[model samples]
Target: MKAPPPNILFFLTDNQRNDLLGCAGNPIIKTPNIDRLAASGVRFENAFCTSPICAASRASYLTGTSEKRHRFTFLTSPLQSAYTDISYPATLKMAGYRTGLIGKFGIATNGIVPSLQDEDAVEKMFDVFDNYEHWTEEGYEIRQPDGSVRHLTDITGDKTINFLRTHQSDHPGQPFCLSVSFNAPHAQDNDPRCYIWPATEDHLYAETQIPEPFNAHPDFFRQLPKFLRETESRVRWQKRYATSEDYQRNMRGLYRMVSGVDRNIGRILGTMDQLSLSNNTVIIFASDHGMYYGDRGLSDCWQLNEQSIRIPLIILDPRADENNRGLIREELALNIDIAPTILELANLNVSDKMQGKSLVPLLEKKKVDWRKAFFCEHRFHRADIPKSEGVRTQRWKYIRYYEQQPVYEELYDLRNDPHESFNLAGDHRFSNHLKRLRRRCDKMSAECA
Candidate 1:
């Protein structure tokens, strides 16, 4: 007998990177739940976001297209001219699964500088998030709640719990998809003090080792703009502490925030177990992109380096295949592939318009030529310069800004120059390599087009 479709509990985080989990090799940040997931599921060692900015990357994940295709480059607008384009979640509904979305939507795509962020614009972004109240048999309906909502992460989890509580057994054994997004550890207010994390130095144990290109970039501020001098928190913090005492304070707090969400995830997982959905369910945890945490002279997660583009992706589907349980795969994966993967998991029709290939075959141990370079892009400053894109192959990373920026090119040999301190774009020795990387950029742009 053919088995029923498996339920999908999709968890998404904002402004997150790949190094948070102990399983991902950061010893100090405690993410027992995320680590547990890593231990039990396949972890994509080379996963990447299609774009580093919040809105553009989130839109790419939703629409299953490249930034060039979706054209939702700015946060406020829908992709291109199509407001009703069938996003992956909406497509799940076509495949006979109920769907729900909660938490941060990364809707701020218009190049609105943070310094000039209008109060009204922030409210508008918040409104787009709650515009679609909930889904029903009739159709996706508009919605607004009268209850006081605080802390986007808490609200996101609560909504998921509420949806689960209300929709018990509504599927009549058919599978459902629940997209629960959290805004934790994203520095919501742009102020570290505004962070809700409770992890402190006294409670934290010894600092865990974090591997990086440079032991420390203490002089990061020397090259940064004056306004962004405070961006080099990592370097400043490093100089202040004699040992690893508070080295992990901010990081431990991030872990606590992740742990907060993980606890809720545990509850959600426990709910599935109670409902007897474990044997036929798929759970996924990933982020739109990563954060800098004061790395490379950057205050936030807007940079295009591996620190900002590399994100964590895990898939745990007991029904998909039992053979790869607790198995970790190092194959290159991109956010572009998420659409097809989800569609394949739901046994639904994957659109021809989708650019990513499914990981189902790879998960099943089937051989395929996956990818060597993970493509990523960003428009963080949204300055007069139009665009910037990056391509990271297994050994090297190349980045180019396409417009009026003063310094517009970068190339790094990940194996040797991990800090990306030296830009080789103008070097005669790497001219051939630069040509190759430029060709890659053109190819990716064409593919995305």
Candidate 2:
């Protein structure tokens, strides 16, 4: 009998920063389970999202295409069925894999309030789809089958475990793909407390002193362009980080939410081990996009800053040779690459329409000519957020706000100014360098379009 393919477990978190994990060198945040996953898998040291917003990045991850190609951005836009049909989950399902999706699927929220009615089309992509949107009041108010309300993270973990157990019983010889998306660490915009987590996690970082980033200072906020200084970012900063107490409260709440999610992940990992599925299951951990914890006086993740664009990517393929296990790669990885990687892992061919290249070569430690740079873009979300695009190379980053009058630009030598503190776009000393990057950015933007 031919052996079935390996099972896939993908965990996607919301509004998580790259530096949140203990393995990522943060001394404070507790992420033992994720750190364990990293210890047993390959961690990409510099993974970034193609788009910094929730819907666009999630779409990119599904279709393995850029935002320009997917044509889904903004809060009220629904991802086209055409794209969803070709999405990784849909493709995997077509290829005879039992696919399940749990937790928050951000791409289906097209109206003022996320409705299950609107998700009827996208729900067909998965075999066992639980399309829950915790961002909405109705979605968050849902109770478990036991008649007890729980945190969204706990509910998601329970659903994931149930799905795994059911799949094991119904299809012991068949492979399955399960996607668990958790809406954690993302601030509750409608809640009075802003950030919400389990009550048990209230003391996770209570006594710890959370240091503010350098850009959170008023002077740094003043240094921004007039448009940025007046954008919704500044308003959110005022609400979350204007005062020391507010900063600490919000930061601690955010960390607590993350810790809560991590605990649920630990439970999932334990279940996998108990079921003896750990060895044959390929595990992936990542976020939709990075978040800004009061960086640049910004409280959200619309900007092209490093804190907003960079995300954590860890992949554990049990089939990998010993030499590649627990290896850390410095090459750039993007959210769009996720689909191709999963398809490659299933021993399937990648679609030509996918702009992302598979990371299988890197996981296998094979010699390949990788990309030199990648382009990222942000379309207008609100009146406060301007449309912008940029190209990031290993040593430099160039951002241009095309919608703004006079065309604002930012050029940062990432090697020298990793925090993006200095914008050398207007400096005559680097005129040639800036000009080259601008042309490169323009060319890449055109190609992506």
Candidate 3:
């Protein structure tokens, strides 16, 4: 027999990487809360986000489907809600759990929220948590990648803590699903100085000495294929908000952002424990996607490098789930898996329409024959840029483009070329391997479509 469902505490940070924290092996980041969580629960070393853009990636995370299927492919575009079917919160509410969201709701379901169409669903999903309305001042500017200036991490953290305290006293024993989505260190926001970091200007040199990975020459574009280089060149100039010391300064800021977010997580977790919600509540910490902290001469990631799409996913299931409490699953897992996992853990029936498989059984050691590969993609962002997709296996990564008349693609043998500098897509040495990956991506696309 199954134990009663525990409350859900989901934490999400923006533009984060799996390798940025001290627990994940980065000595420079100071993330004690996340480190503590990693020590006590399952740490998925190969977690990947379905996409990199804030809108598309978030849409996938929320709906348990891909961008192409959700049709909310870019930030400003409206979403087609039915394609992905039931959301994590909506499903939980249907199963008798109270639901609430804190911080930024990145995937704005256009003007109307069909999932929240019922009065109960709307109240269950949005009634408890506070977003920018009360969190920010009337005249304060909303941060943008091109011109951002507010210190959002502190504000976001405070607001999240407050929301939890309010609800902590409201429902003493009933089960609930509460999620806090945070924006930190993302490249699209305004200028870079508004966000705080751990290392100051004086300590930058000693701190960021790891140096840029492949494409060692930030100027390696001249050798790239024509259409591919054109997109890379413009992306290079924007600098993705890292302006001072090339990739080094960008990375220093990134490390600062992750460490800062970690501190906030510590605050929220501490409050939960104080309220006695920690022991029974399940805590999940992850990012929308990984960051490109100067890897492959790529400061901002829209690529398939390990540092780009792979992010940190740590699941701290309730005290009683027992099977593999502190285990690490090497299975290839992606973002869509999260929605269904949350649903299944709450004792809700995972909708057949859900493209993701739940992670509960894997946590309980019941899923021995899991998946072999994870599929992801980015579509129609810059009108001039092409649609892109990535396939991640245990040791290989392939990213292809639908840009010109011919498909322009990139393939990397992770064991030999982890930095992903050389494009082996057209190389004769690995044609068979590349073809196999392309076929898998096509099948996933057809399934989602």
lDDT leader: 2
Each candidate's clash count: 7, 0, 7
Residue-level lDDT of model 1, residues 249-333, one tens digit each, is 5555556677666666766777766777777778888998886665654445555777878899988877644567666777888
Using lDDT, rank the candidates from best to worst: 2, 3, 1
Which candidate, 2 or 3, has the higher lDDT?
2
Better of 1 and 2 by TM-score: 2
- Order the candidate numbers by TM-score, best to worst: 2, 3, 1
Q: Residues 362-441, candidate 3, lDDT per residue (tens digit)? A: 67554578877777777745754556786777777878876656877778888787667677888898999999888877
Q: Which pairs clash in model 2?
A: none
Best by TM-score: 2
TM per candidate comes to 0.81, 0.95, 0.85
How far is 26's C-alpha from truth in model 2 (Å)? Answer: 0.5
Give the distance in Å from residue 177's predicted Cα in candidate 3 to where it truly belongs: 1.2
Candidate 1 vs candidate 3: the lDDT winner is: 3
RMSD of each: 7.1, 2.2, 4.6
Model 3: per-residue Cα lDDT at residue 288: 85
